[model samples]
Target: MNNPPSGGAGPDLSVTIAGIRFRNPVIAASGTFGYGREYQGLLDVSALGGICTKGLTLRPRPGNTGNRIHETPSGILNSIGLENPGIPAFLEKELPALRELGPVVIANLSGADPEEYAEGARILGASSIDMIELNISCPNVKAGGMAFGLDPEMAASVVGPVRRAAGGKPLMVKLSPNAPDLAAVARACVDAGADALSLVNTFKAMAIDIYRRKPVFDMVSAGLSGPAIRPIALRMVWELGNALELPLIGVGGIAGPEDALEFLLAGAAAVQVGSATFAHPAAMLETIRGIRDYMEKGAFLTVGELSIRQKSPRARDRSGNTGSPPQGG
Candidate 1:
């Protein structure tokens, strides 16, 4: 892993999360990158922590009809509606091909209801996938009536069966910032059966075409992602870190090594790079390189060393003092 590519010198970037070993802390966020194979020609995908495939459903979905993706100032709004090729096709075809790719494979599953979620977990758990990320929350589709993530009770209830079906494979629940009380819901998920957690899927946002005087998305609202959501996500990740003993994977608006470091300091076991992948196909590789560079300069030996938390300068400044001097090089 010491070989240098177009990115930077790859250091000892390995880290273990929920007992799953990853070559690096940077994972390719789901939806942004297709089932890990799409970028085979770009760079080495295996160098990443893991490849999280697009959200999967029980059956194939045609997805939304019009204007599924729209670019925003600092981010992107999407209403892809969990479009997937269905689990059966994934098991028969995609899974085999993805295995040949390097790095760990994390299967992200979404279902119309609790039963489907349990079934998907049962099948995937028995497969070669390294982990299962339950989509208890996604903000794009309003037509589903309920996302199963908004209510702590519903989210908590769904995990037990999925955990049983998972057959001991690590189960990480994706969290929604749209929840009325995010921390409460997170606690519920942990108590129910989650081994780890990934969070801040996307904020519920909407756009307007002034000329048409109508919503830009056919679904009326879409999931907002990118650098725009990083601050809020950092806060939430910190809050969760304070409230739970479980590993947390931070997502939302992480565009560079600095952002990833912020999440780590706030207590994220690891962080995922999402919208940035759309702008730079090799972004994950670059992020891995950047993290290595930062770590080397700081004389950190591993990702666990990256979790050192510094006192907030804002709080100190408010109390009439400068912040703590920057520690890392």
Candidate 2:
């Protein structure tokens, strides 16, 4: 019998993020991929561009109380609360397995304080991971999560120390969609020495438990992620990509290949698959194939060959304005 096709008959999907080259633009979002070990038996982990490990802290955390997740119409709400085995245990156990995956490994670090942020960075800086993504935008927690990301001054302070501790590894400061002015926050992180930026961790939202007449989770609020957030994430990516000179990793509710393509068209250097993985563990691989097929059908030679095509003046007029509208409008 004839052998089945190996790779997609499409354009190359290689991309670069903050000087680190990826064979493809598909990366697993932090806290969603679980350190690249869980999916090893199901898929070829090396086929991915990189793996952003679960958000890590200086000390282990048990996470939030009962009912950490709830399903929404087109997305999911999570109050995971940055629970992880902590950095030390991760370095000892998870790092080795990830190294075997071939592609770059980006450690996602979060902490309750600035010093802890720096400490986690310093510890990971000595490791073999390719980069570090500072999770300054997680909104599920009560303290030190979205707090650092929402305020420009606090965002800079949180990122500055981590940037210093990153050693030679590229540091990407993940921003929050909840920020009043995302571009301002992006500029602050860049000013604080962030090597790159990642837009839109998630939006703060909550689902009510109709039966209990309370919130879905013990926490009154949670981070909403999935298809419902894509448009907002794409808009933010476009805003930051057009305004800032730094590289950006687009993230939010990227559910499939088309969503990833939209992000790239909006100017993201690479895209991360987040909530989609929960429902489709092979979503990242499928998205990679889809992107390749799209490029091939569109006559694009490579992912880099694509650019954020700005609309003409006439087109902009027809589309109204390009700037962001006031919040809650």
Candidate 3:
């Protein structure tokens, strides 16, 4: 894998999360990048640090109906409801090509229940996928997604089963920003055997369609994502980084290289570019280039060094008073 494209002379932008070394720290967020094939002709998929497939479930779901997406000033609300082509179909059809896509392939796994999540993980555990992104924070789904993520005990209950079922594969739990106690949930996931954590899933939001005198989406609430959520997402990453020692993948409204640099500086080992990809397909690649440039200019040799959380005493002091207290008392 050490070829010209993967290996060049510059400040290394690569990041290693959960023992998986990505070529760079700019990954395509799940739901935005569909299985890495939809964007095959749009940009060089191999140039990405990683690709997270759409949220997958044990059984095929038709997803929610009636305006699953709505655009806002700086973000979009979505109620896709985990609509996906069951795990079996993904294993048979998508996994093969995804294996050849050249970037780290992370399966964004979700389900309606703990057992369903476990079964899906069991199936994926035997596959050749690079890592498993345990998505316990999907806000739009009513059944189990965010339900399992909101509380520390609830999150641990779900993570324990999936962890054992993952067959020792790297497990990175995606978190919901809506959780009342986000740090407690992170600590629970880690205690339950999670290797890494990604933060700031869309906030729960809604909009009214005055013309129809109804809601913009069938479900009254949907997941909010985009530049509108980036600042808050960065703060969440910063808070978690100060509280835990796990690798973090920051997601939410990351549109450009400067935005991504903010998350890394706030302590994210990697940043996932989502909504921006809809407007610019090469956003991730541009971010990768931008990060390399930033690193070179700052004399930061590795992605880990880009973190100002631990290296700066001021950041540490600020973190102590940021939000709620750190994980353990």
What is candidate 3's lDDT per residue for 1-329, written digit by digit as tens?
21223346877676777778888898999999999989888888888989999999998999998889899999999999999999999999999999898999999999888899999999999999989999999989879999999999999988999999998799999999999999999999999999889887899999999999999988899999999999899999999888887788899999999999899878787889999999888788778878877777777777776766644333322112121111211
* lDDT of residue 4 for candidate 1: 30
Q: How many backbone clashes does candidate 2 have?
A: 0
Off by over 4 Å in 3: 1-7, 311-329
Clashing pairs in 1: 46-102, 226-253
Candidate 3 — what's its lDDT? Answer: 0.86
Overall local distance difference test of candidate 1: 0.81
Query: Which residue pairs does candidate 2 place in steric collision?
Result: none
lDDT of each: 0.81, 0.83, 0.86
Cα lDDT of model 2 by residue, 1-329, tens digit: 12211475556676666678788888899988898888877677788888999999999999999898889998999999988999999999889989998878999999999999999999999999999999899998877888999989999999989988888888888999999988888899999988778878989999887898987888889999999999999989888877776567899889888899888877677899988988877888888878777776777776654545553323321112232211110
Give the TM-score of each candidate: 0.90, 0.90, 0.92
- RMSD per candidate (Å) reads 6.2, 6.7, 5.8
The per-candidate count of clashes, in order, stands at: 2, 0, 1
| Root-mean-square deviation of Cα positions for candidate 2 versus the true structure, in angstroms | 6.7
**Across residues 98-149, which tens digit of lDDT does each residue of candidate 1 receive?**
8888778999988877788889898898999999989878887653313677
The alpha-carbon lDDT assigned to residue 16 of candidate 2 equals 63
Which portions of model 1 show Cα errors greater than 4 Å?
1-11, 142-146, 309-329
Candidate 3 clashing pairs, residues 3+ apart or interchain: 226-253
lDDT of 3 at 233: 94
